[model samples]
Target: MKKPLPAAIAGAVLAYCALATPTALAQPEAASAMEEMIITAIREDRKSRGATGLDLSVYETPQSLSIINAQTMQDFGLTNINTLLKMATGVNVDPTETDRTTYSARGFDITSMHIDGVGMPFGNLIVGDIDTVIYENVEIIRGSNGLITGLGNPSGTINYVRKRPTNALASSIKLTGGSWDNQRAEVDVSVPLTESGSWAARAVLAYQDADGWLDHYSNNRQVAYVVVDGQLTDTVTLAAGYTHQDNNSDGVLWGAVPALYNDGTAIDYNVSTSTAMDWTYWDTQSDELFAELGWQISDHWLLTTSARQIDYQDNSEIFYVYANTGVGLDAATGLGLLGYPGKYADERDSLVLDASLSGRFNAWGQQHQLQFGVSSARSESEGLSYAAQSGFDVMPPFPGWNGREVPRPAFAAPIVSAEQDIDLDRIYGSLLLALTDNLNLILGASAVDYTNDGVSYGVPTSASEDGTNPYIGFTWEVLDGLNAYGSYSDIYQPQYVLGEDLNPLGSAEGKSYELGLKKAFANNTLLTLALFRTEQSNLEEFKAYGDGDGIDDTDYSDDFDYSLYRGIDVESEGVEIELAGQITGELRLQAGYTHLSLEDENGDEARTFIPRNTLKLLMTWQPQALPKLAMGLSTRWQDDIYFDSAYGRIQQDNYVVVGGYASYAITEGLSVSLNVDNAFDEEYFSSVKYEQVYYAAPRSVNVSASWAF
Candidate 1:
């Protein structure tokens, strides 16, 4: 199975062309040959569910759009969410803990995640690691999108388009082996339930077992998804599906390696080092059930309703190593290595319902679009903590440490420490008016009510908030292929984040403005340049790990469950430019560059750890000399970043990580690829939140075989 994969998932899913059958059970177009594979892989007409709720095209969205389609995923083997987001132009994926990650765009954390334009139950807080096998494409809309979401942030929104059942018979299988004993297998199949192809079902399953670059770290992940679609009537369609993802990690690092010495001197260690204990484990699972109905009121009108229920749970037994003062470790004698352990179980049940009516009409000699919707989401969470008796809590050796020599602590006496309920309700609508043949006016607004009630680890976590977010945009087609646009958007978010004092940090409000130019070409090719600014208050800033700030009282407990954050006010301004689709018949590319500046109300630099300049480049080309060969290159570069730590400043120099892939088509239906990440073996810190920081992975290689039909 040594071949080009998608020229064949592309050269099969394009196998069922015509996304036209809006009915879930509509027939899929039979895919053709690979002559236009590069162009087709770069763009999709149906990827129009972003920016506004009106399903506008990229040229009309008035915002930055980044898309990673299924063809790209199969080409690069981007089977995980974090890997996919890293390729997004303005987004950053921060892995603070071994098993937990936070995504950021512009200068703030990205809290919004949607499925098929419908908001997720709890923002971006899924319990398990996100697996991409179940998604058709991952779309990102940079800047505020309050018009499409009930809760909004300055960061962008990530919309995941779930893969549906195809009206035709299709299937694919993949096997991969990589560096560090990494192994993975995946299978995707679609079957027609009815002979006429009026009904269909699709299922995807995946499993991966891999060892990390860090010592003693390993991961085992599994995913299963199934969806069914049927035609109830000539104009009515029904679709339902379920998804399950499980992730279990062993020896997962909690915090990171301390960056400094207690004496205020910088300390550096090997990139492969880890403080995670050998016996520790973090296991999480997420299960969801969803249903959707669509009624075609007329050729120009459609009404849609969707509902979903989600259940998520996480259980972990983990350990943390830190200094007694919670600041830095001793340079000599390797002293003051304190060990902290905990046993935790958390569960969340969420219900979300959404309904909308969208259509087009002719008015004033022009065609206009309108969409209105109502949505409600409620989530209930429960958490239990078990007392951990750690005999190795104080004074352990640090030099030559890996955590394998450490003993696991005993846990007992579980107590219900956290119980909370969160709810959000909103009414939203948008209208796109064709004011003139060359100009358009877009208006939208959402009124949201957010409430939270519960107790978390002895802290009173409760709040009530209601706000209106309004959006306005203007677009003018300056030329036949160029459009100039400007937009204004606002954000209102209710927060449950805790501070160093252990109380809820409260709510946050923000506004964003953008002006940009878009150039569109044939085959959905797009180029965009944008200037944006934002002002926000009550944004949470990371303040080290643990409960107390060392100086706040001399007693630093070994409770690693509670991290610290504080509210702050900040202003952010940035410029971004991006390009997508084919540059030549043989080459297609997705590239972006961003320059950002963040400052506090007092004019002091804020969130200094965020890079001021970043650039992402991804491109693929099929050489004419070798018709069966495809090659691609990916690289991400950033400016220097620094963090003000307790003892001193932690900094990382500008660095670039490079990845490349080569695939050869063995046959039209099967392929093999060799992908090398960090091809140059560049080493840098992935994060610098505390005295401890994480090191980026070194060079790794994987060889994958795929079969598509």
Candidate 2:
């Protein structure tokens, strides 16, 4: 584990205090003198020294953007990354029975993930934590972000902004209990270190435990986060942060028995009476460290830089009954025989450099708001996987069965590879001109360079060099309180070695055009509509190159050809419409919807995993009218998927999931809340791969209470 430099720095500061505090207190007039010293210290901090130049308003931004504020998180009782996805627009998370989830944005792979504007290549493992108390907001920017984020898919970028300390001290403590013995507790605190509010700090801690709906399924999670900011002088500021999370789970409830009974009659997955036993267990942990420094060169120009490092590890055990049909059913329920089991480890490091300048300029007697920035990021990922057998017994097929591990795999040769490291860079410039009070025109473009190297289970050898991507966009304030915008962008992805002949693969290219409208109605409300088309060319795919299963020692190559993907997207897109400021006085309402249509131009379903249609809706009601009450409802719909497969054409029917929440105030600083997920207990499937169907979770409830000071 790498020690944090911030900790060492804190220790040194504390040491200095230990030696000086006593002497200062010893002075007879020290009490009055100390007050003056404290006052002076605060005045120094208030000189605007350590402040970031970045603006926080989402509307003032150039592209389509969304923000999930802290209040929205609590009203919906969204703690985990999965819950957040369900509540967001145009984002999808497909969770497999194996407990692995894949994320998708627009019509392309969701490759861009950031924390506070810095790229995080290994977002899969980093977002595993379920602590809503840690983040201040989730910021999403739609379209090519190469200019701001460097190397990334043109579909856009989503960044999780952490909580920061405010001058006024605030803290909250929460406790939760739910069905199936599920329980949780959390705390969040923020304070200023100086009276002048120059130095500030924030902290968050959380824990959760649950006994799942399925037999032998259980879960435990823990999280801690801390951050601090300080102003050193008139021109310099510094900030440091840390986060840690741990998760333990019994396993995922993959899927149930096939719909067909032995007699071939349509039957539900829950109706199967066949003898069965399966178990899955996994443990995952992660730690993150970050630091930043800001230098204000002048009033019109500024520079900022930040660095982050992430480390993660995982261990898993899976067991299930297997029948070859040709061979008799095996009774050996221990390791090595039943299902898939493996151990996974990952280490990643990242660095980011970002700087920008914005100021008003007079041209032809017209005032223009011009802004430009250059950003760069480099990241590396190293992960190792180990296969083993189960360590438990097989219980007969049933709804709820809890069993212990009966492990078996001994040591084996370690297969080592380095393929996850990524290096990316970009430079961008933009100019926005205010044609008139209600009219505006903007033009922007960016140039990017990216590279990747890695080997996966299927591909033993893989390496790709830097590829350039270009982007362009325009925005026009068409009418009073209405804005229209359009953009064109491109992105590229490399190839990995599959089975045989270095699978001939080349750079995959993507191009998209979008048009949207933003309207502000009476009473400070906002409404927006957007339509977009995206096409991808030269797509790389995994195809069988040999006669065998493509397993074992076989000639394989990183070879693929350009395929195509095209799709259209529509989103309601506005925020703070009904809930802008006044809602039942204290009651506030927020809501929106998103619709998407994606297509695989190759028409080869077996090669492309993209879905056709996705729909999402979210509504939040916070009644200040009652002073202490809040409620929310959320729904998601994924349309059917039809595509070409090796065996035959495959189709996955669409399904809908709904969730709701309600909370009440116990006092000015105390509150309680309840949440319901999959409220109808409806059974549905999210995906099907290799003829295997993965079902969604069942009805679940959670109740919580909180206190703040």
Expressed as tens digits, the lDDT of each residue in 1-709 for candidate 2 is: 2222333332222100100111122223444453444323332322110001123133334455666777777777778767786655666565534355656656554566766655654333233444556877776566555545444354566677777666568888888888889888888888879876667888899999987664556789999999887566554556777889888886543332232222322333441121122345566787777676654444433345555655566655444332222222222321111232334455555555555544445686676655465565555556555544332233333222334333434434444434355555666655666666655555555555555555554443444556455555455666767767665555554433342443325455666565677766565455656676666665433333232233332111211111122222222121211123223443344444555554355443322344455555666676546656777777776666643433344456677788888888887787788899889787765555323343556788988888888
RMSD of each: 7.0, 8.5
Best by TM-score: 1
lDDT of 2 at 504: 28
lDDT of 1: 0.78
Could you estimate the TM-score for every candidate?
Answer: 0.92, 0.77
Tens digit per residue, CA lDDT, model 1, 467-529:
999999989999998999999988787777777777778778888999999999987789999
Cα misplacement distance, residue 480 of candidate 1 (Å): 0.6
lDDT of 1 at 671: 88
